[model samples]
Target chain A: MPIPSPTVITAATLDLRGRPVFVRSTGTTDGPALILLHGLPTSSWLWRRCLPDLAEALPGWRIIAPDLPGYGRSAPRPGAGPRHLGGWLHALLTTLGVDRFALVGHDLGGLVALTDAVARTGRLGGTPHPARTGGPQLERLLLLNTTIYPAPLLVLGLLPSIVPPFADLSLVWLGRGGAARDDDRRKGYVVGMRQLLAPGTVVEAVEWAEYARPYGPIAGWREARRSLRALAWQAPFVLRCLAHLGDLTLPTRLIWSRHDPFFPLAVAERLRRAIPGAEPMIHIIEGAAHFPQEDQPAEVARLIAEFLREPR
Target chain B: MPTHTPVRYVLTSHVEEHGGRPAAATHAEIFEQVALADSFGFDALWLAEHHFGAQAGMVSQPLLVALAAATRTRRINVGTSLIVLPLHHPLMLAEQLSTLNLLTEGRLSIGFGSGSAPFEFAGFDAPFDGERRHPRFREALEVIERAWTGEPFSHEGTNFQIGEVRLVPRPTRPLREFAWLGAMSEQTAAMAGEFGYGLQLPRGQSADHYAAPIGAFRAALRDTWGPDAPERLAIARCVYVGTDDETAIAEAGPSIRRFYEHSKGYDKTKPTPAAPELIERLHFIVGGPEKCAREIAAFVAATGISHLSIQPIWEGLEHGQAIASLRRFGAEVMPRAEALIGAERAAGVAGQD
Candidate 1:
């Protein structure tokens, strides 16, 4: 039996903090909000498979997935650091008039969410920042395949420091198109994205094209390199915010990919122990590499729904 | 009389190396053998896991090797003959097995055992005490079964203090069907039956050694799951087929002796038997097609096993010779053995009438 394709995602651009931030959304706007944040090297397209299902599962809740400041169709913001990305999320939520919401973050987006949560709860070991004053009330937090400790980020972070241009250059080279056409460039980016999935996963051509579209041009690479450079530069501050993870008071849950080479189960284990209010076990998604959303979309959506529907 | 059951042939390997062969080459040969088994219509390929012993078996992670085999073959099922359960965290093992099952499209089977090597347990920093081992194994298996349910569960056991956790990518099928317990003792056999898992009888033991355990296993299954419950029993045997009995012994005799010599070095306390008595005790089935078939039929009828896992390759055996034995067994011995079992079953039914 053939499985039906996921529901089509609706995309639009919203002006947040003087920059054009692209958002992919579904469900009613007036309902309680559920914001999804994508990580590095990806945009709102990361949530394409899970968005509609999430919307269907929640029924009345608004599901909003936005590209990080410098990814996909969103215009890159100059001088934005890792912590600044968290501030950018607050600004995006305020601009969207989302006062109370649940947040789900993956990869680097998870770092951004943790930073924001820490800052909001005034746990950053300093005077509370202005972004914490009137931000959206975070009801539930979900983190997927992300790291709080600095050890896991050392490879990606230190590579740039050790060999200044080696990381981005290789990515750009591997992401180079065979031909001058835009479709060829998209296919080239698809090749790069293929490395992030579990072996033997059969992805559709159209879906691959959608995921690779944002990185199809030289401008996309420029934004991606900018994001990477910012992350590499702000590693210390990110670690500082992560250190305050024990201070987070929100109801948190971790859904991790078991085979994720970048952020292994050990990282999730640490994070689960760090968070005081975290659910006892780190829900492990098997048969997936870095991206569980792509490898097990229905399961991801179902887990999200199950978590969100739990009585507070 | 034993119940009539159709037989399944599985190619089992310890991935043993000899002749100063490199470990990489041994693995390459095993994969080639896996492809051969797949093409030759064998039911499954099972690999053994051994830690810190490259001579006995180089494969420390049999599930990874099974995953490699699963990817290479189209139809053959891949499995671990026994994964040392107590050495690994159950949640992690469950996740890995679940991943392998999904990647293979439900063609993954697993055999669990509380390992026999005290040194290996010490190496893993696990409790090697006999009293703690059984309880730890039971706790780990229980945790794994609950984790496969795709629902939030918690366990506060003697060995594990797990909080609310759920497994993802859920299970593709009922995991019990793919589970096997490697049992040598009557207690362990009863545990296997209680857990509703297939029972795998260990190799290198005589038929008399297995009789009590087999009886206990059947009784446990009948008492726990009812009389009509399905029984999946498997036994391993060292087999080699040549032109005839004399030639077979001449070719395999020295290699088999060397294999036992290497095994004896692992434990010096047990008295070592001479070559021929050791061969008889281990039940090495070496001969031409007709003789091998007759013995295999007799062994199957005696043990009432539905699956026959054959170890045709051993240390010091040439790869080509092992392949030839495999080809001959699949082509000649298997059919003849089936015919013999069928005749015996028919005669049993005739006697009953």
Candidate 2:
């Protein structure tokens, strides 16, 4: 039987190396800081819509939603690609004095956030940056709308040097015109994001306006391209660090949006083979796309909150 | 962009009283007046700062003025005409501006300046090296911007070292307002142009003095920087409008004198006393709606100025008269001015076709 979890929601922005990174926190700040990294073209704003519900179920954890570079209010990275990307994430958390966290990645943010966690693992062990070692040491890994393929097999292409304008005209074409759409199915999206052992019962709306608010003028298409291109440099680190996935022995959850355009569900079994002892928690949402937060938000939040509450 | 609801008048205010008006009293008065400006249909209001005065009540603080302006008005965009940058760290300014932006829910503009007055920098230990001020001002701006986005940063340069300083409580929107550099000289104006920031030209400079800077700004924006460069360019000019020419002249004359007198710190050459016609012709905006509108249009065309900040309330003008004048500007002047600039922008966009 699925266990029930509580949900919470809050909105805020944090500074990341002189950049304004907008964040949406779900759950309590006391239990653990779950830095939920958002995927391509979307921002921490995506979590906002479901934050209130997710917050309630995860009573003691703080859920953070930060607008990664070149998305929402966060400007482009001062330097390009994975090296600076990992450093910036480390800098962002370090600036906040958050020592340890349970790293969760969705789509692009998942890959980047995970890579940074692994790169800074030494720093998290009292090496160079002393303050980084004290808190939660990447206790668990939650990957939603993600692709962990090692090389040329990755689906999405990377961020380009010269991106075409009007890249986002498709989202508008897709009919997400700031008005709430498809009210009925959101419950499932919420259930997935909760990390409790038993999924919490939640209303369809997850702080509706908060998550939608940060998507200014739709730079997601451009951000997706950039984030994917970023993987070229980031993938090696990911492959290397993720190589240590079996060694850590932490519970790894893969909440896959089955209809995701980028990551094929057929790869799930392959993923299990790649990371030994992966302990995969497969969540296949029927009608969701690459961005489960936008496509199936409530369920994603519910699954995350429920997963976090489970006994290891 | 929201619909422009016929803004006819423009007003500019500053804590000009040199000895720094008692913060509490000034705060109450500014807010009270600004709220009234919103209700009364004023288009825009600007607040500027000058530091350290023996008696003239120098209101050296820019962030404080922005805060007061935020609480005082809604609908009207409040701006800092020039926040003397060298006097304060840019990171602190960024945080203050971001907080003020949140308070206003996004109606804040940060106007930056490299302190010109030797006395103003004396207290802060900043040298009066005019040559160094421009570079220092640019670097300081970078530091501030860096702090706005994230954790502590270390920037090593010839003059300043920004080390491990983080700016918390960032604004809801990052770099929303147009960041303008107050350019009293061509060099500084060119620097602002190079950086793709807006330019706030001084009130008294002629079209020729402005031509080089404005030209530099446009060339840099179009050729050097991309088209997405800061789209707003504005200059400061003294403006007062009323019914017939005489009525307008009657309201503005004495106030113009005081404004000019106060501005003497920057322009040491005393303004020569002139006849009424000369004052109306060159220095002030006076007369009926048609006459004022024509002057504004001509000024925009002559300078290719996309925006202008006008001072409607003077030191001696009655508050009632000022409000009435603001109403006139909002209803009459703004339409004409916007149309003129709009046409210019449209034509420019058309030429792109």
Candidate 3:
């Protein structure tokens, strides 16, 4: 059954221990809320294709997409990075009045959501608190193409800022997938992703005409850029937190694109070995590159539904 | 002087984020603010362009065009208060502005300014020599204007060296009749006169200070370009209007004073009474409609300002206060000033007859 037109509700940025954070909900309010966290350089618009199906099949599900502080629509917190992100997500979910529900995260969101599960466990006094024994007993931990050891990226920073500025540049070029590289198209990605820190396909949906509405000028984009760059430097702490994921007893599933240029299949295999009591099913999306959600939304959605239906 | 028809008040945006205003001030808020200004009868809105700041003030070309996208649904004329001419090659600026003009249905004003901010000039690696910047600005302006003429042209000047280039998506008008030279010095004012362009007074300067520049332009036009030169002059000032003196003084005085005081060469942090002088000057039109009318009249008497661009909003000023102030300027203050202009124009006609 086709779901009715989606309803979008924008929530004001809440003070999470003095951090500015916001949440946006699409679909029904009474449904089980799936807190969808996006990756670097994109917003909830990354999930545009999968949302309709999730909304249709899981009529009891409410899709909660929050731009993490320093990404998308959310304002940045004074201190935000991979290590502190899980706790922040926990606080954000609680503030939004969401209780126990399955958490589905992708890319950066997956790491954040799993970390948040541990933090939430501690908050709810669940067994094996990350600070105490570490990790949590989440209902289900869903992950997309994400890295296990965030260390290698940090060591690359040993190079001077000028030399390795092209490090991320190479990644971006790969992400472009050889689209017609005109000034508009090139600047669209740079200004949208690097400057605004909130660029996504939603720009295509809205038409680029008034896209400037969400972003006033380069100044706003630059501010977002500065904060994102600072966040990129916090990779050491992110690697330190890897030990905590091992303590997670939750049934976890990892979905990855076989040909992901950023996180190879080898990294996903390492993640499977690291996690405790991991689920048997791992979906390796073929042909799709970094974002299988965009390239293979239907197949990914089907796999997710199948995974969720398996008996505990 | 006020005109026969009521003067329409303009609120310039410049997409600028100041001390109190952060870069993250939302677009939803910006759009709503413009709409509020329009409903209250603001005649025009302007956005500025800038590349880098501790806070990125503005970040793109077609700055006016982007702002117009947010506001084209409304009635007010949308434009760049002044796009820095030195930073962009003329051909690029010409193409962007022309497309913007065509898109906005002639609801555009082409404002060209010599790059002012030292930081902006340095960021672009453009020459920061103030004496040389004006010539470059003028050269770029010549190229831009020629491209807008809808006729193929070529020009080589001190800074700009564009060869036979015709602008695409040309505007309906062969030339933008509303071209403005954003003049900060007497030399620039004279250049505007020599080039047959309208004069745009700098934002922070008082009307009294403008007297010399305006005079120099008129004198130069008469001496070299001949007295037959068409008069096209405009002035921009920071202004705030209220229902009464107490209300205006209480609401807008601090913010407006802080703005000018923060401006280079006029630091309020020093022990100076710049605010008091500004309030008393012909430049700032504050208070009730009648009082504002009087101030404008005094300004016209002091300097023959035909077009006035008044900034009625600052970062911390409440939206309601700005709306009330703009409404008063449009409905009451404008008519009184227009009547004054009508009287002056009539007197001139009588003298001719």
DockQ of each: 0.01, 0.02, 0.00
**Which candidate order results from sorting by DockQ in descending order?**
2, 1, 3
Least well predicted 10-residue stretch by lDDT in candidate 3 chain A? A158-167
The candidate that wins on lDDT is 1
- Residue-level lDDT of model 2, residues A1-312, one tens digit each, is 877554445556676657677666665555577787776545677566567766665666677777777765677664345545656666676665565677788766766655555555552232342325453356777777665566322434432322222233343335464435333112212333332112332424545333333333334334445555666755655666666544444566667664454455544434544554455324455346556665667667766766777776
Candidate 1: regions farther than 4 A off: A1-312, B1-4, B265-277
In order of appearance, the predictions have TM-scores of 0.53, 0.50, 0.47
Q: Which model is ahead, 1 or 2, in terms of DockQ? A: 2
Show the lowest summed lDDT stretch of 10 residues, model 2 chain B. Answer: B1-10
Write one digit per residue (lDDT tens) for candidate 1, span B235-262: 9999999988778877888888777777
lDDT of 3 by residue, B19-76 (tens): 4554455334445556766775665666566666422354345364455444445666
- Candidate 3: regions farther than 4 A off: A1-312, B1-8, B15-43, B54-75, B151-158, B204-206, B219-230, B266-278, B281-283, B340-353
Winner by TM-score: 1
- Per-residue lDDT value at B178 in model 3: 55
Whichever of 1 and 2 has more lDDT, that candidate is 1
So what's the TM-score on candidate 1?
Answer: 0.53
TM-score of chain A of 1: 0.88
